[model samples]
Target chain A: MTPIKGLVLAAHGSRLKASNEEVTEFTQVLASSLIDQYKHIVPAFLELAKPSIEDSIDAAVAAGCTDITVVPYFLAAGRHVREDVPEIIEERQKAHPHVTIQATPHLGVSEALKQAVIHLL
Target chain B: MTPIKGLVLAAHGSRLKASNEEVTEFTQVLASSLIDQYKHIVPAFLELAKPSIEDSIDAAVAAGCTDITVVPYFLAAGRHVREDVPEIIEERQKAHPHVTIQATPHLGVSEALKQAVIHLL
Candidate 1:
């Protein structure tokens, strides 16, 4: 069986401590829920938050994972989604050529999201 | 017709300046697209960004809007969603009891969001 390695939840970290914790807690909950399939689930941040994308990717590689999937925990396809993330991915790919990297998309407007918004309304 | 009023996009403005501008730009684009229905679409920030929610709401009321819809530019249901926003809404409601206020939900993981994410992948 192809070794299913790591799932990395990447977020834009906030300088506010509580905000950082919020994203970390969310990632933890998500990781726990996906424990069955993913042997390892980690949280990384673009800034402010700890264990940044670079560190998380390196950690995953160091932990004997040849494959990593990066999931961006963002709402829109802004500069971070359009530029920063891809640049990071390219850098990581070059640094760890043997490791396969897959970057998921930003969480954009969708039915479920719209419904969630409606529920809040 | 009841004076169709304003739509406010509330975001957590970043100190990084560019981040704040990005959200502002996105809100402007959305507003431009929604001009037919909403006479005014304004961008507000919880912090850092200019034109706070309080200010935007006040502007809407000043502009003779009896109803205002606040859409949170957030990705998940965190403390901001569960706590901070409700307090702001309550305060707004009390201040402008005659003005109808609607607080929409955070853009949680949904089909559309998921699809958008997938598209990035």
Candidate 2:
């Protein structure tokens, strides 16, 4: 049987609940847009918010996702992006060796961000 | 004489100097793209970094800019975006009525952001 593919949008969570909600809401929007490609697109946080990255990965694995991608929804590479997130994902990968767990580059590094800024101008 | 136009990219500053530098570097890239329209494209921080919004506006005015736009480089409409930035800009506007100072919608609200995410996938 073909395995299910899942995605997790990992964000630098905010103290403001509303701020975190914005990330969750955007994750839903992404899910809607890529409905065919991913069975689940979950929102997780690194700190100061609920559903940490580990929990989200566990949930996805429990839901029968054999392949999962964690995309950092951050603008720049900080300590969290450079050290924390990758370390967590590496540990999780060891625990779920059968599952293909990968972390992509953060959103800020994308060329599309430059285009977005240009579009605003 | 034609009035000079300036732009300020206001970011939620980070303690990590490298992270702050990323925003500054990106502002330079934006400046390059908008060379014809804006004479100066400066980068400022809400906090935890140098060159506050007010200072950027002051510097731009000193540089002979009659019109300036402050673009919030944030991903969400949080307190910093909704309250702090506008309040700062409002006070600055009052102080510099001769200059047309305006704050544009943040980068996150742009449709280009969604397109950027799509490109990532």
Best by lDDT: 2
lDDT of 1 by residue, A3-66 (tens): 7678888888766666667666666666655677666778788876689899999998888777
Docking class of 2: medium
Complex DockQ, candidate 2: 0.51
Q: What do the candidate models score in CA lDDT, each in turn?
A: 0.73, 0.86
lDDT score for candidate 1 against the true structure? 0.73
Across B1-121, the per-residue lDDT of candidate 1 in tens digits comes to 6677688888877556666676666666665556777777887888766888888898998888888989887865556767777788789889999889888766554445444443443
Query: Model 2 chain B — which ten-residue stretch has the worst lDDT?
Result: B107-116
User: Alpha carbon lDDT of residue B18, candidate 2?
Assistant: 86
The DockQ values of the predictions, listed in order, are 0.26, 0.51
Instruction: Report the lDDT of model 2 for residue A26.
Output: 82
Q: C-alpha displacement of A26 in model 1, angstroms?
A: 9.6
